[model samples]
Target: MSAARDSKSLSGIAINNSPHVQQLQKTAPPHLGLVCITFSKEVRFRTITRTRYLQLPEEQRETALKVLYRENLQRLDLALTFCVRNSIRLYRMPSGLFPMSDLEDEIGATVLEKMSADLAKIGQRAERLGIRMVLHPDQYVVLSSDSPHVVTTSLKILDRHARTLDLLGLPRSSWSLMNIHGGKSQRADQLVGVISELPENIKSRLTLENDEHAYSASEILQVCQRAEIPLVFDAHHHICHENLDSYDHPSVAEMLYAARETWANPDWQLVHISNGEEAFGDRKHSDLITAMPNVYREVPWIEVEAKHKEEAIARIASAGFF
Candidate 1:
């Protein structure tokens, strides 16, 4: 594949020494990465509690959460180390890193503060390693929900995520974006209105993504334009929901280019790439990316959201798709 138009500068690959870095240095974009949850038999790492906090005795809930939080942060440190060693520059953190922060409001702040130093250290390490770290809260976090309670809880979750990024000393910009999908299609307008009122913490670093269901790329682009937040274009999601077959398809390319405009920083214009399972299961990310739409070769950063994590990334490289 030919080198992307501006791949070298965008992927931060000029100075790296690892052999894996060579793969990135090739013609396509240099920074190709995977999301959270490493699948390694030797490591056996997990950033979540083995037992649910609420299931514990009431008196023990606080203590359990503390232990879980500490372990999770420690695992995050390990994960960061792994990324640096492997020359993986972009990563999406697992939302469970701070457990119960949304449901148990009173204790969440205290627990997060207690781990601030450690979290900051991890963030600093990531910066040093040239890793572009990000987070995606689960489906439950819907800022556009019709229910006030859902919106309220969603903000808390988003606030916690923003605060976590703040603790890492990440700037209030696209570099440390906390991305979310445009919620139910019917509420796109409502979602934008609610987003306008969010505090600077949640608003400044927020991003909206196009999901396979509900909102199409065009729909989310409107929301992103209105909210002035970056839009994360997902190739598979668009193909499945937007009726676009491949990234290089003329119509799909137009929408992808439009989505690129949503990003304020061209250096951090992150996109997602994945192949679906079957026609009926198009929403499901396959274990390996069988093919990537040719149009993605020049994008700044593409988060490989396959079930196989790093393994899928290796497969993509082997296939010479980029």
Candidate 2:
């Protein structure tokens, strides 16, 4: 069978045939949010450029990046506008770029300043529409790496980004949600200290997520308690990490429970949902909104990370997330 078909078949077996799936599906949570990333077919820069410099002319790359950035902001504005028109309450801002290292050489103090100013313009639009913009940190920043320098450099970069946020004069709440992947084992302790040492304002906005391997929701909660940062949970990551034996389908209830127990309150909790087959991992454009009860009922934001934004939003809207 083709990969897509194989994946779907696996998901069907994991969910449709499982008794646990039926029960969890029936017992939908009361308060949930839908937070989706601002992504579109025409707007993603990640696949467009292999190397930062090659993406555009050296002299014009900055301008090009800014233009691309604005296009994404506009796309986000349109998405939020749609969500508002439909009465959807929550949405996450495009992290704009991923893996801070990708932009480290490309983005300097001047470029960062410009990006921050531009973000302010985007934030204004979102604020006017009553939308929230959560800035996600790069995914590859492994806090638990044996390489101490990597953690330090990542923190420094994050600090620079925080300063840019301050420079933009964006309200703390709007740009406050900075998501990071808490690294594994001993690395977590060191990263926690670095996170704790951050300036009070920046630290207040930091949130750590549970990844597929490095940490569990419960483990991250412990780290958050030490660092005093908030916790964000990716439901899929928990299931994949825990390898829970009780259910064949992803357990929305268990995921929610993990977040609540670890994070203390739902207000500080954020959830990420995406569609994927167990065999293929997370499919680029698959839709799993229907599989998630909290997404349809309680969560404030559901950021759809799909192959394309149009497909992602259309699928979520069809699932009644909006």
Candidate 3:
């Protein structure tokens, strides 16, 4: 089947109404905010340093958790807190190992429960600072798969996290925004239905993102319209996948405008910006920042995915994003 046909099938299965469209109709387009993942360097280093979990000793495990909590959880709290104090209203947290397939062993229910408690505490802190937290998903959990096991496992992970959130008495919207990649063409229909199956409260928080290989902004918007989810754009993904001709000096302004037109939304649209470099014949994260001039006109929650977090922040500051 064609990508469009696959998207249609997914939409048919996932969306019964158009909440995002209706929302746009009711509210003026809100300025998109700038969001970042804190302590990205430490997290990436640890993950790649050791491939096998069992290779780590007890002390290493403790160290790993400390780093995970510090980077994935604590530092996020600190960054969001800073943003809030500085009048920045939006941010996204890294998905990390939180909702992975091996959560039961890598980070058990008890760990999740503790994380929830910590998040609740962070939420209270955020309320004081005026920052909104959105939890992004890891890239591996694709909903559109022929294997029922993949879909079932993904739902199970979502349920576990949802339950953990519930335990903290946080509203679904509190950490509602989740980022998901558009699935392969063959499984788009099933993916859409899976999205539709999400509870209304969760549905309100879900947003689909366009990836380098799977879909484009226009394609994702159509699926979002049908799935009742909002659409998010990743600038790097677009350039890496669609605008390779201009990769070295990408037209950030034109791309953002095109994405906005595709989604036709003015209400606090979410976007991601990253630096990409060729490594082993594949695009990998690099230390590049979005050109502020191109995106200043639109209020977007920008996350700098670079080789180094401090460098990314420096670039953003130099560009006057702060």
- Candidate with top lDDT is 1
| TM-score winner between candidates 2 and 3 | 2
Clashes of 3: 8
Q: Give TM per candidate.
A: 0.86, 0.68, 0.66
How far off is residue 178 in model 1, in Å? 0.9
Q: Candidate 1: which stretches are off by over 4 Å?
A: 1-30, 41-51, 279-281
Q: Taking the tens digit of each residue's C-alpha lDDT, what string does model 2 give over 80-134?
A: 6766765555555444442232355555355556666565675676677765556
Worst 10 residues of 2 by lDDT: 3-12
lDDT of 3: 0.54
Off by over 4 Å in 3: 1-89, 97-107, 110-118, 164-171, 244-265, 278-282, 290-296, 320-322
| TM-score computed on alpha carbons, candidate 2 | 0.68
Q: CA lDDT, every prediction?
A: 0.74, 0.55, 0.54
Higher lDDT: candidate 2 or 3? 2
Q: Pick the candidate with the highest TM-score.
A: 1
After superposition, the stretches of candidate 2 with alpha carbons farther than 4 Å from their true spots are 1-88, 96-108, 112-118, 167-169, 173-175, 245-255, 261-265, 278-285, 293-298, 306-322
